[model samples]
Target: MKQILQSLSSGITEIVEIPCPSVKSGHLLICTRSSLVSAGTERMLVEFAQANLLDKARQQPERVRLVLDKMRTDGVIPTLEAVQSKLDQPLPMGYANAGVVLDVGAGVEEFSVGDRIISNGSHAEVVCVPKNLCAKIPDPVTDEAAAFTVLGAIALQGIRLAQPTLGETFVVTGLGLIGLITVQLLQAQGCRVLGIDFDPKKLDLARKFGAQTVDLSRDEDPISAAASLSQGRGIDGVLITAATKSNEPVHQAAQMCRKRGRIVLVGVVGLELSRADFYEKELSFQVSCSYGPGRYDPAYEAEGQDYPLGFVRWTAQRNFEAVLDMLATGRLDVAPLISHRFPLEQAPAAYQLLNSSEPYLGIILEYPDPQQPNDLLNPTIQLEQEHTQTKAFPSESHTKAPIPHQPVLGFIGAGNYATRILIPAFKQTNATLKAVATTGGISGVYAGRKFGFGLATTDPDSLLNDPEINTLVIATRHDSHADYVCKALNAGKYVFVEKPLAIAPDQLDAIQSTYTSILNSGTSPLLMVGFNRRFAPQIQKIKALLANLKEAKAMIMTVNAGAIPPNHWTQDAAIGGGRIIGEACHFIDLLRFLADSPIVSVQTTSLGGVELREDKVSFTLSFADGSLGTVHYLANGHKSFPKERLEIFCAGRILQLDNFRKLKGYGFSGFNSMNLWRQDKGNTACAAAFINAIESGQAAPIPFEEFVEVTRVSFEIAEAARH
Candidate 1:
C-alpha cells in the first residue's frame, strides 16, 4: 500500500508503494481512513535530518560519543559503515490513525472485520497494528476527529499526572495542538486553565476553549498574569507542553506554581533547573510518558496484555478509549484543531508545511476507501522490471529443470543484520537474489530494491515453492529457525540459517528427523548454520596453528556481551532462547571448529540473584580430543572494554585474538602478530564459502553434525545456567 517514508540521510519525504503488511497473531490489519501528523515530534526529526553532519552531531552529543567509542574499538571504516546503514533505513511517518479493520488475526477477539478503530499506526493505506495499540472508535466520532484520539490521549495522560481538581487553576505552557488539547481536558476536569504561547492564533483558539491566555509574542508577563489570576496565590499547577531548548519556561512555571503544586512535562525542554526554584516550595515534578501507563511496555502493547482497570486506572489504550468517549459526548471538540488536510499521495507536500512558515496544526493525511480496489495493497511486489512472471506453488508433477550448481538465494528476513551484512555479503558472491520476505513488508522491499532482488514478498511459502530458488537463507528470529530450516530442506533446497539452529531440544529433534528423512530420499542437501566466527581470518590462522599441536589445548573466550534490558526480545527465553543459545553459541561453534573434535561434555555457571542472570555466565566444554574450552559471556562489563577476547594455551605456546581485529602469538616459531585496519567478523567470507560449496557440490561449509552438536551444547549450557 502507499505509505509515507522519510529518508534520514537526505531529509527527503515521499509517498512510496509498499507491500501490504500481513497481520500477525494478536494484530489487526486495518485500512486507514485518516492519520494525523505530529507536528512537534516530526518537525524535530525532519530538522535533524536536514541538518549538516556537524549540526547533527551537535544535536545528539550522546550518539556522537557512542560513535567515537565504536571507532576506537572497531576502527573508523566499519563504524562509518554502520552509521551510514542506520541512516539509510527508511523511517515510516505518522502515528495517530483512524481506520476500518480489514481483518483480525488469530487471538484477536476484541474487533472484527469492518469495525472502525483508532490506532497509533503509521501513515499507510493499510496498517497492521497490535490489538492493545488499537481501540474501537465511537459511532458519533468521525474518522477525521478520531484521528486525534492518540494525541488527545497524550494530553490526557499529562493531565492525569497533574491530578487537577475542581476550582484549581492550571497553566498549560505552549498552546500548540497538544497544548490546546491539554487546556480543554483540564477545563473538563473543572479546573481553570491559563494557556501560554507566542502565537496569537493559537492563544485565540485556547481562549475559545474557555482558557485565559498569555501571549508571549505580546511581551506579556505570564508569572504576574498567573499570580493576579490566582489572587496573590501562585497557580495550582503547571503543564509544560512546549518544545524548546530554553530553560525559561520551567523557571517561569516554577514561579507561577503554588507551594507543593505539581508540574508535569509532556514535551521536550531544557532541564537545567535552579536549585532554589524547586527547593523552597518542595514542588513535585514529573515527566509524563507518551499516551499513558503502557506506552513502551512490550508485554502490554506488543503482546496484547492489558493493565487491570481497577489497579492501573488508565493505560495507553484505555486513555485512547477515554478520549474517544469524550469525543462521542462532545466534551472534546477537535474540529477546530485540524488546520490542514492532505491526501496520502500528497504527504510530501504536507510535510513541506512543517518546514515552511505556513501555520498548520493537526494536519491529516487521508487514504483511499477500503471499499475501493487498490493495486498497491498487494502482498508482493516485483522489484525487478524484467521479471514479469511470478511462479505459483508447483505441484510434484511440475517439470523439473536441470539443476545448475549456482546458488539462487531466497532470504527469509530483512532485519538489521541481514540488510547490513548478510545480504551485502551474498551480493558480493554474485548469488542470484530471487526474493526476500518479511512479515512487515517495508524492510523486505527496502532490501530487495537495494540488493537487486527479483521480488519482495510478505509470504515465505512463495519463496519455498519457487522452483528457480535453489538456496534459502534464514536470518529470521531464533525461535523460527528450526521451522524454516525443516521447511526449506523439505522443499529440496539448500539451507544457510543464522546461528543457534534451534532454540529448543525438541526443535533440534524435529530438524534431525527431517534431515534423516531427506537423506533417506537419496539426496543430501547442504544444511549449514551461520557460525561466521570460525571463518574469520584470525580464527582460521589460529585453527591452522593448532592443527600441528601434539598436546591438548586449553581455550578461554571472554565476551563483554553488554547489558540488554530484560524486556528485550533477545532476553525472552521462549523467543530468543536466552543469550547463551542465541549468541554465545558462536563461541561454542568456534571452539568446536578449532578443537576439530566433538564436544563430549559441558558445564555451566551463572551469576545469582539477578533477573537476567543467564546473560552473565560461564560455560565449559570438554572436547573428545582432550581439548578444553571455557566461554565467559558476561553482560555486566563496561562497554569501553574489548568486546571479545580469545586466548589459547597449547604446546608451551600462547595465541591471543582481540575483537576479531588483531592476533598475537607468543613462544611460537616466527609469528609475532597480525592486525587489520578494520574488524572482520568473517561475514563476507562465510557467505562466499557457502556459495562456493553449492557451486562445487562440496560438503556444507560447516558439517550438519557440528551444527547439531554446537546447538545441543548451547541448549545444555542455557538450561544448566538457569537451574
Candidate 2:
C-alpha cells in the first residue's frame, strides 16, 4: 500500500509502495474512503523535514543526543548505515480516516465486513489498524464527518482536561480546526467560550462554532478583552490549542485564567512560563495527551483491551464514539471546516498546497474507488521495469562453479544484529551481497538498496533455493537459523550462522553431526559461527601481549557483559536459548582464545535467585594451563554503560579492554600505560577473515573443535544455572 516516509538523515517526505499488510487478530482492515490532513501536526513535520542538517539538530537537541549515544555504542560506520536505512523507510501517514471494513480479523468481534468504520488508518486504499483505534460509524454521519472523529477526540480530550462546568467561562487559544472543535464542545457543556487567533478568517470560523472571537492581532490585549467579557474577573479556565514555538500563547493563557483556575495545553508550543504569575495565582496546569485515557497504553490500543466505564469513563475509543454522537445530534457541525479535497493520487499536490500557502483548511484526501490501479500502492508493479531489465549474476560468479574467487553472498536477516554488526562488517570483505531478505519488506528493500545489494526478497526460501546464490548469511530469527544453514549446506553452499546456532542443544548437535558426516564423506561445506570477539583486534592484541608472561599465575577475567531486559525475545528459553547460550557464548569463546588451553571444569552463580527460564547464567572456567576465567552475564546494568568490558590479571600485570574502545596494560611498580584504539567499524575484521577463509579454501577461520567446545561449555553453564 502507498505510505509516506520521512528520511532520517534529510527528513524528506516521499510516497512509496509496499505489500498490503495483513490484519492480525485484534486488528481491523479498512478500505479508506476519506482521511483528514492535520494542518498543525503535519505542517510542523514538513518544516522540520525541509530544514538543513544543522538546523534540524538545533530543532531537536534531545533527539540529537540520542543519536550521539547510539553512535558511541555501535561506532560511526554502523550508526551511519542505521541512520541511512531509517531515512529510506516510508512511514504511513494520516490517522483520521473513514472507511469500509473489507474484513474483520479473528478476535475482532466489534465489526464485520462491509461495515463502515472510523479509525486512525493511513492515507492508503487499504489499512490494517488495531481494533481499539477503530469504531463503527453511525448511520447519520457522513464519511467526511466520520474522518474528523479522531480530531474531535483530540478537542474533547482538551475540554476534559479544562473541566469547565455549567456557567463557567473558558478561553481557547488558536482558531484552527482543533481550536474551533474545542469551542463547540465547550459550548455544548453550557460554558461561555472565547477563541483567540491572529487570522481573522479562522476567528470567523470560530464565531460560527458558537465562540466569541478575539483577534489577537487586532485586540490591544487578549487577556483584558477576555477579562472584560467575563465581567473583569478573568475566564474560569484556558485551553491553549495554538501551534507555534513562541511562548506567547502559554503566557497569554496564564494571563486570561482566573485565580485557582486550570489551564490545559493541547497544542505544540513552548511552555516558558513566568514563575511569579503561576506561583501567586496557584493555578492548575496540565497537558492533555492525544485522544484521552489509554492513549499510550499498548494493551488498550493494540490488544482491544478497555478500562471499565465506571472507573474510566472516556477511553480513546470512547472519545471517538462521543465525537460521532455530537455529529449525529447536530451539536457539532464540521461542514465549514472542509476547505479542500483531493484524490489519493493527488496527495503530493495536497502537500504542495500547504507548502505554497494556498488558502485551505481541513484538507481531505479522498480515495473514491480504493480498488483503482496505483503504482504507489504496489511494490511488485513499481519494480517491474527494473526486474525485467536486470540480468541475474552467473552461479560461477557466486561460488564453486569452475571459478575461484570471492563468493557472492546473500543475507536472510537485516535486523539490528545484521545492520549494526554483520552487514557492516561484510561490507569490508570481498564478497558481493546478491540479495537481502527480511520480514519487513520496506526495511529489507531499503537495506538492499542502501547497501548496494543486487535484490531483496521477503521470502527466505526464494533466496536459499536460487542457484545464483552460493553462500548464505543467516542473521534472521534464532528459530529459523538452523533450517537456513541446513538448506544452504544441502544446496552445496557455504553458510555463516549467527550465535546460539540453535535454540536447543539437540538441534545444534544434529547440525554438528550432519556437518561431521558431510566432512567425512569428502564433500564438506564451510560453516562459520559468529563468535566476533575472537576476531576483534583489541582482544587479539591482549592475547598476543600476554603470550610471553611466564610469571603469570592465575588469570582473572572480569567481563561486564551487560544485561538484556526480561521481556526481550532473547530472554525466551524456547526461542532465544536465554542470554547465556545466545550471547555469553561470545565471551566464553574469547576466554577460550585467551586461555589457549582446554577448560578443565566449569562453575556458575547469579545475582538474583530469579533467573531466566534457561536462567541468566554466569560461568567460571578452569583451564588446563592453570588460568581461571570468569564470565559475568548480569542483566541489571544501565543502557549507557559500556556494554562489553574485560579485565585480565596475570602475574601482577593487568590488561583491561573498555567496551572495545580503549586498552590499558598495568605492570608492577606503578608502571602502567593506556592506548586508545580507533573505534571499531562494526565487525569488518571478522568479515574480512571469513571472506579470506573462503578464498583460501581453508577450514573456516576458527577451528571446528574450539567451536564445539565453546558450544558445549555454554550449554553446560545454562543447564547448571537453570536448576
lDDT of 2 at 636: 61
Residues forming the 10-long window of minimal summed lDDT in candidate 1: 386-395
CA shift at 203, candidate 1, in angstroms?
0.4
List the candidate 1 regions with Cα displacement exceeding 4 Å: 370-376, 384-403
* Best candidate according to TM-score: 1
How accurate locally, in lDDT, is each candidate?
A: 0.89, 0.76
What would you estimate as the lDDT of candidate 2? 0.76
lDDT of 2 by residue, 1-723 (tens): 665555545656666655554556788777788899888887777776777778878988987776787677656765566665554454556788998887677898878988999998877777778888888899999999899999999999989988889999999998788998999999999999988988889988888878887887786578777888789887899998998889988787788878888999999899888997688788888999999998877668766788999999998999999999999998999989999998877787777776775677899888757444333233221122223333334334545442454577878888866765687678667776777776545556555655657666656676777676678898977767777777788777778888867767777777787787888889857888888887777777777778787643354444444555675667767667777888788888888988888988999876665645343446789988888888767666555556667888887788877777777888745435444434552267777877888888887887777877888888888878777
Q: What is the lDDT of residue 552 in candidate 1?
A: 85
Return the TM-score for candidate 1, rounded to 2 decimals. Answer: 0.97
Q: Give me the displacement of residue 619 in model 2, in angstroms.
A: 6.2
Please give each candidate's TM-score: 0.97, 0.80
